[model samples]
Target chain A: MAAAREFGVPLTLVGDRERVEAELARHDCTGLDIELWHASEVVGMHDSASDAVRKKKDSSIRVAFELVKGGEAAAVVSAGNSGATMAAGMFVLKRMRGIDRPAIAQLLPTLTGSTLVLDVGGNVDCKPDHLVQFAVMGEVYARFVMGLQSPRVGILSNGEEASKGNELTRETSVLLREKPLNYIGYVEGRDVFNGSVDVVVCDGFVGNVVLKLSEGLAETVGKMLKAEIKSSLLSQIGYLLCRKAFNNFRKTVDYAEYGGAPLLGINGVGMICHGGSNPKAIKNAIRFAYDYALKGVNSRMAEKLDESFPKSVREREANEAPADAKERVVS
Target chain B: MAAAREFGVPLTLVGDRERVEAELARHDCTGLDIELWHASEVVGMHDSASDAVRKKKDSSIRVAFELVKGGEAAAVVSAGNSGATMAAGMFVLKRMRGIDRPAIAQLLPTLTGSTLVLDVGGNVDCKPDHLVQFAVMGEVYARFVMGLQSPRVGILSNGEEASKGNELTRETSVLLREKPLNYIGYVEGRDVFNGSVDVVVCDGFVGNVVLKLSEGLAETVGKMLKAEIKSSLLSQIGYLLCRKAFNNFRKTVDYAEYGGAPLLGINGVGMICHGGSNPKAIKNAIRFAYDYALKGVNSRMAEKLDESFPKSVREREANEAPADAKERVVS
Candidate 1:
């Protein structure tokens, strides 16, 4: 609400009536044009996203998605359960044409700039085609949205060697080589922080672990540094003197600086913020969603998919033939 | 050699004779009982370990393992290529009676003490039984070497929920529960740094990535802090005052302080250190290898495996029946 009010973006708030009213009463919004939409139910952060989407017909998340699907809003930004947001987006807006699976593109802060890692916590088990699609989508995101000319794409692996990864990564590397993108072969986890590449692609399992592990490590390091600095009077003086630089460093490493992760390959613009997002994070997320909608990322993704995946689509269709027949028989 | 000399252990140096003699001459070894063994070939850091073991018939690594296998040495410690060390250990000493795979147990420095993560870079791809065996081996190391009474064991995954994780983690979690160890369910990547568990188990691919990424991130963080401190006059003064504290912090997180990773599940005690290990690191590696051998960790691991995996071994044997039949048919 603060973000919309400050940015002068016409905003519609959706939630339980009393809670929304109570929250509105807490904030000053005298001249801002705002509308409140009542949602009969609220989805808890730990609730199963798919189950909530299916069971709670009038949930705030579902209603928010409905507003977007009805063309009432250009985008939807959620700081609630990430899984629910992805589930709702998939259920309401669906995947773009030729996209096998949707992915979450997380912008990791690097030494130079930021590296975009895809499928951070979306699809756990991914196939070679899915990874190739992720590379194309991540490339388009880096080029069109993140403003890179030709993003260097890399498949996350155990080693930098072409033959170093497991079956998934090895197979994906072969398929990635067939694409027109700036493929950098295989990159290890260290490459993510060193700004070695613009985009890193992997199955959601590895990506999610890497993302969370980085967060945990950064936090732990900060805590340890603070404790060490406070242990002595001399260090305390030093910390006071270097506090500004430390603050700048914190900003660079902080996830709040990136706002939120964009849910890519979905038909509409949706941004999923951390569940513990502050007002600033939410504001930034709203800004990202607005920019994403303005840039028509989804349409460009569709075009890129058509251009890059003609062979893959055909092969996937051939592979699905028997499964489709089995489905038909079951139906 | 320095450690052996200091500890008064009879040391047999296996490498190119001239180089070993030169190194020995460089260090004062007048009273140290030392013997030099000649190895015609040396394995390069990047060479495939298994291939190097096969082709480099008289390599230093192979010869060192042979000494241990021939009961000429209590243990073998190498600060060279880890893959070569593991390969040599497997080829020369082979696996323990019922153990299917050996794992590299890496001790990760944490805020409160440290956590032991197994399979840091041993088997890139692992199965449920492999992970269960890793837990048994890791638990024994933590108990006997690290001296934890009953170590908390966790299977690294994306979430803490029972249902959270990929197929491998889910299966491993089930197998872990069947063991007699302190199974802590699924732990995320963040949990490893948070010191949430005593032993963290995962496939080599993820574990290797996590370990390297942490090293890279720690180095980057230190560099970034130094750059920030030098950016301004106040920070420069502050850094001087806090230099002691910063050094202490660095020591706490330093990989060198942890010595080296032990090769567990092998029939003999073997250690693999970082290729860039200094004399101090090499000394620590030798110390760890000595302790590991003295404690008879391999024999204890065999006993633990028998106690924890009665059902798993039976099931695995049954599962392997078909493969054995296929091999017989082909033969």
Candidate 2:
């Protein structure tokens, strides 16, 4: 309701009708462009993503995507099982033209503003060409959403040097260099949070690990601080005095503020939320989804994919190289 | 000097003799069994690791390894180029018996105490067999050095589910289940510092990123806290009152407290210190290296490898499966 009131975006709550109405009535949502669409079935955490998508036709995630597919909604956002959301997205909205795979682009708070990371648990077994697409999709999000005139893109690796990384990163780095991007060669894990680059692209395995590691580290740090504050009477007194400062610090490192990340390369905007998302987080995700549709980022991404991969990755790998890409390759 | 005095281990300083002697004289070293060994050359950061190993015969890193090779020094510790150290270790000390590749094992402070993570920028490209070796070596370090009777070992992946991993981790998980050690399946990046497991194993690419990400996040959090505390006059006063609590927080999150990690699977004890390590960190590393030598981890590791891999990976891959391993695989 806050999202509709604050962002002035028409909101549609897709879930069990009674539950949705109950939340709206309790919140006293007045003078808001709010609508409700009922989805009888719910996808549980342990439900297999593939099985859920195939069998649960009326599931919340599936029904939400159907709304987008049927032109009733511009975007879909869900704080459900992220895997189910991704699976529903691909099965319903389908992959964009010339896009081989869709990827999840996540926003992380950095020392300086924020940075975007792509392929976070989306395509686990990604080829180098797949990573090339992730970088492009990441670029679009960094530009249109983050409002960067020109974003510095970096590939996540063990070392900063081009000579570093394994077979996958080594190959991906070479491909990224050919793109018309502000490509920084390579970035270490430290660079992700240090604000050295705007977008850090990697295969899903590495990116997923980075996302989870950041969350875990933040929790560990918060718990340690609390324990230390309660160690002595003087420390407990100090905690009371510094409560506001601590609150501000928590907000700064908090991941919930960022809310949902879009599953890019899909036909329409589909935002995947954290399972533990609060009301504020859900509101932020709704606002983000509304903006994603308003900005027409999907069409721009489609254009970029074609312009970047003139002959498509599979064709290029098949030895049928386009003249423009070949010329850039030599240069 | 502190390590020698505190840990009571005889020490040798390997570098330019004049420079080493000047430091010893300035410190008024007396009654300490400190010896200075001269090396005419050095391996700067920019120097290629392979080039240095082959060309720089008298380089300090090479000389230090020589000390171990000749049995003059029980262990070696260096904060220089980590790649150079690994190269020198492989060249002079050599890989241990039946070990296809050696790995660097790092200690990270967890929610409870600490956990060991291995293959941190040692071998970037690793096969499943190599990861199996990393797990075994990590188990050895955790059991012997960490003093855990039986360590809970886990593979780093995107999810805890056995079904959730890339090809490398998927294959590794199957092989790990056949091991005699206490093998927990997949642990996500969150599990590394959450005290969910005693040791986390991964390819060098993932492990290196994890290490750097932890460091970067800590720095980011500290900076955010400082910025918040200085935002207002009230926060500044609060900061003054909470100085000790803040200091305790810093120490708890400080990576310097862990000091250095040992390059396991090498024939001798070689502790690899962080480039930004302080004097106290260096002392801790030196002391840890002394304990590593005294405990005879290298020889014990060899025994473990043979016992675990009755038929070496190469031989097993050649279709000659050992009866012991074959039975375990069926089970």
Stretches of candidate 1 above 4 Å error?
Answer: A311-331, B311-331
Q: Chain A of candidate 2: what's the TM-score?
A: 0.91
Candidate 1 lDDT over B226-287, as tens digits, reads 77888999999988999898889988987777778888877777788888887778777777
The alpha-carbon deviation from the true structure for residue A100 of candidate 2, after best TM-score superposition, in angstroms, is: 1.2
Report the lDDT of model 2 for residue A141: 86
**Chain B TM-score against the true chain B, each candidate:** 0.92, 0.92
Which lDDT tens digits does candidate 1 get at residues A1-331? 6665676666778888898889789988898767788989878978898765798889888888777777777777788888888888788877766677889989988778899999896588789989998999999999988899989999888888876899889889888888889999999888888988999999998988888889989989998888999999999998999999999898888788788998887777778889898878878887777777777777677778878977655654322110101100000
Q: What is the Å distance of residue A102 in model 2 from its true position? A: 0.7
The TM-score leader among the candidates is 1
Error of 2 at B19 (Å): 1.9
Q: What DockQ would you assign to candidate 2? A: 0.61
